[model samples]
Target: MSIATLSATPPPPSSRAARRTGRLFALTGAFVGVVYGYDTGSISGALVFLSRDFHLTEVEKGLVNSILVCGSIVGALIGGKLADALGRKAAMLIVAGSYAVFVALSALAPNVVVLDLVRFLLGVAIGISIVAAPLYVAESTPARIRGASVAAYQVATVAGIVITYFVNWGLSGGGHWRWMLGLSALPAALVLIPLLRLPDTPRWYVLKGRTERAVEVMAMTDPDVDPRAEVAAVSAALAEESGGSARSLLRKPYARAAFFVVGLGFFCQITGINAVTYYSPQIFEEMGFTGDGQNFLLPSFVQLASLAATVLAILVIDRLGRRVVLLCGIGTMVMMLAVLTAVFGTGELSGATTWIGFGAILLFTAAFNFGFGSLIWVYASEAFPAQLRSTGASVMLTADLVANLLIAQFFPSLMAWAGAARTFAGLAALALAALVFASATAPETKGRQLEEIQGYWRNGGRWPVAPEPREVSPGPLSPTGPAGCAERGA
Candidate 1:
């Protein structure tokens, strides 16, 4: 295949079809984000009320939060195979439905055991969403704006987190934890509505040997382009990587990539992002932000800041590129966490100190948004060979949830036992290490197609410079191919 053959024969630029296709793909992230945010954010306020109503001890309260993460670990492990078997769109819709049903059922739980079980089920949906949705977006989108389109997922997540705060604050006044928990179902339900209109991933269709359907889906997802070459490319990549066994992750070349991705996922959470995001108000109260109840406002700002950072990342991801942005973001987070540790180490620092501490937190949120939050899932989905993409996503995200579970379960107790200064400072050290790891190991993925990335990983940092557009041949007809695939334009 030659470059000319893979060149997108887009409909007239004057046509509106491409824009519509782009919008649809972008919204997939938005829907996914809302659901993710609601599930996570709703828990805090609900847990507060439940602890009061059910007289939960500190350990029990932690259990309520940690149980979901446990379920997520299980879901992420299996999610890849499900995506491979069911097709990305179908898998996502099924997860959404499962999330809705379980969340609603949680509202009716009569005891802690039942509540924990229901919450665990909800976690499965969350885990599945983390893997399948991103894979779908990566496979469905063209490369040029791939960062921005898929970024909608992160943006949506931040939005979901912020909106749930508003929902929790509104319902908290009435002491309706059930309403807070139940409110999550709305986003899940809404996601399902639009999902009915979405097309399956072209890669998945091709893997199933439905090239004609893959072409049609490409047209619907990017109508301005003739998808024949892209379809052919996807078909070839699927053929080369057809055995979707989870154990294959430990085999040659893939083994190293899997290690890094799983490390990245686990480290992303161990930074204590979820700890604060999940329990911000409690932390603020400990800092002495008293009963003005302005604590609710903290997470909203964090979410908004995160959203802004994600937008910035989208613009520069293909420009300044992934490794640089991650360095900057994680480095900033380390510095902010240091300041946080210093402030909290002083023991009962309140008022201005508390506000400064919060300022430091906002910076951390910005850093995460720009760096790990945006890149983690994107890289996880794209960094692997086609055969291992889904399974790799599953393994990495499962590791992520395990870290999430640990932090969510023991963080409050750790704060009490270790003191705020030591706890945050420890997290700061982890962030520093993450920054170093990213600089030493992460590759520049800007403008490279997914196929180009495969060679980048396979060569272990000695990968060749990408071919100039004019000199490039179309090469193979896989998703990772030099031409005819999403990476060609990326």
Candidate 2:
């Protein structure tokens, strides 16, 4: 069935139980974010102490920070392929196992080389988690709350970052960077227990020719939707094309989805969010917060702001829609970046204007979490047809990681050569680009079924290929049905 046919009639409101059921599947997948957020943010404070221990040059510090992203690229490529083969559940298990080993190894490294190498391996775990976890949530849940479900991944990630910021603050006094790095192992390992109980996504089951199993899993996770209908929808999407791979994403129909995801991710990263995330302490220090532990302390609040905004985003994304939220956020970022760039150029950020800079960063954090942080995963999960979902996610995330790598590697040098003012000016230019790109290319995916979303791409990259979904009256559903969790996943 084409999306126009499948979605011709509106769905009634899902029962509380069904909503909870889908959320269970999504949140379980989202737990990977705990480790992902912690690992990603831990370095911000840890770098301060780690550099002291390693006596590292500026270039080496960049290398240490960026090597993990390189591993993530590798992991995305490998994990995307394996998730297609073994299943999302099995791929997550692999991610969990790698995190268990490599994080411990990272904690116990004997030298900078060992630390860099081990961190690279840990990044592989993160890479796989990013690819698999959000995909799991999106495929496992009902379309009614799919936006919230996928946003759960981002929620978990921001929550993880919040936890790490506090951890970093607590450990900063003693400079216990090793303990900070090692603590991520527990959450990374803990994801296994829940994943063990959960089934692989129904879509993956159907793709693997396990019809009976697919129906069974859907009944458990998305009881609000009829199993037969979902199976047909997946079959139709799969029928459109087969034998997909990374190369296949470049072909017609799939090509536009590929470009959209890759483009969104590229612009999102180039906005220099990670420059703040990875080096906030240094940025804070440069911004003149020289109090005891203020660098660590303030960024914790910044992470908290991001966490709160992500939560708010989760509650309303399905209603307010993706493109509007993204444009608003990116627009805020462009303004904040331009103003901050000008402020930094003045070199007079003492007293009142210093607080203005702080407010601007806070706005930037909220704007990012509100749009780019959460919706990126949501959009990536829904953009492609079933045959290429995993491959497309991998390619999209790989492009994201590539841009992330460029920032991690060169940000310090950029800071050195251009100074904060010009560096932010450059980012402001990129943010303007991101805003323009999003306005031009991002199609709203809210309230659309997975099959319907693919239909949008198939019908020449335009939305509303079919009629809009209507909110209808409530209907009877299993009271025992549950919903999914929040994961920035990936």
Candidate 3:
């Protein structure tokens, strides 16, 4: 733990034990994902009953859903600098504690305005974690399994959403909206215990001029490689680097990474995922699945589809590569959104015919999870040079939340005024733009070291790829495909 030397350190553990510790470290940091999924998804069902309880009108509903995002933007602004200063593990601990307190406050609010205020505070907590968790995962895990490791946050998010759906369906008979919102506090508090035990990431330690500690952490988390060499490489990369300031990200070397991160994060939100997440029950009602618990039950299935696709995404993200998954996922979304747009536009959706809309949404949810939802964290975590990683992610996530705020705050009113058909059409057009933008801009990060990825942006946006090591022969590991893990060494 000393900054000057490893004099107090014990001998390193067995490779198997060290690897387990590393995996545990990644998942513990990722556990904040539950707050992201459960808190956000809970409102979808809770909003149904809470609206009736508060006598909320359409605009109030939008305000209730969106106020959290406003707080999130503020949190995003602060999160990067906080993480850089306090370290990733310490930042996550604070975020987790905030979720436990604010969400409980949210559940106990006396009025609609109070609820919005508490939820906004909860949003600040979520925003801060959104910046820290992916950065922590990317730093703690090895490049070989980095995609799936980062995907752990998304997997936890989707899983939390799925679990929230079931909780909502169960509570729908009683109309217990408060119980649904309050339940998130339990997991939030529980996550804190594990997070307390995990070490701060090696990259954070390196940035603080604590290379000895970084070496110790690297050996624990990445047993497959030489820890000292890895730390040395990171140190060299940081030698000329200054602080991870917002202004630094605007310089020419960082611009490409900034654009890709910002564009992907914005499109991820603007293409209408939150519109679905925040109001799936309402959408189901408009399509005639009304007045029964079926509205709640149906979204459970949609969440399941998303959860399953996320699982598939974790399996292939390291193999199929980032660009392929993003393009394919966003492309499928455009088609599905277009189909729903046409169906609703033509007034062809009645009783059983409404099932067509259900199927399309199911596919759409699956596609969203399979690509954009799952991998955005990977790209966000790895795209920048280490010095600006936190700042870059914060800005990208701020754009994402701004888009989310626009959607969450206005989608209900938009649905009332423009109808679902026109809404879906707008989303579909944005999806098309997202697909094309990703095709033109996204660069591959599969099996590449964080240091290796940094060189890509510096080298005029071309990959500064190194050759593969001879010892790791050509073959698939559990996640790597037949082509084997790519050249990971420098």
The CA lDDT at 34 in model 2 is 73
Model 2 C-alpha RMSD to native: 9.8
As for candidate 3, its clashing pairs are: none
lDDT of each residue in 409-472, candidate 2, tens digit only? 8898788778999999999999999988898889987788987788788778876443344444
Per-residue CA lDDT of candidate 3, range 296-351, in tens? 99999999989889888878877899889988999999999998897788774586
Off by over 4 Å in 2: 1-24, 141-147, 219-241, 245-257, 381-383, 444-490
Model 1, C-alpha of 241: deviation from truth (Å): 2.2
User: Which of 2 and 3 is ahead in lDDT?
Assistant: 3
Q: Residue 105, candidate 1: how far off, in angstroms?
A: 1.9
Alpha carbon lDDT of each predicted model? 0.78, 0.81, 0.84
Tell me the tens digit of each residue's lDDT in model 1 across 377-441: 77887788767876787777777888889888988778778888888988999998888777777
TM-score list, all predictions: 0.85, 0.83, 0.85
Candidate 3 worst ten-residue window by lDDT: 481-490
RMSD to native for every prediction?
6.9, 9.8, 7.4
Off by over 4 Å in 1: 1-22, 141-146, 244-255, 447-490
CA displacement after TM-score superposition, residue 92 of candidate 2 (Å): 1.3
Which candidate model has the greater TM-score, 1 or 2? Answer: 1
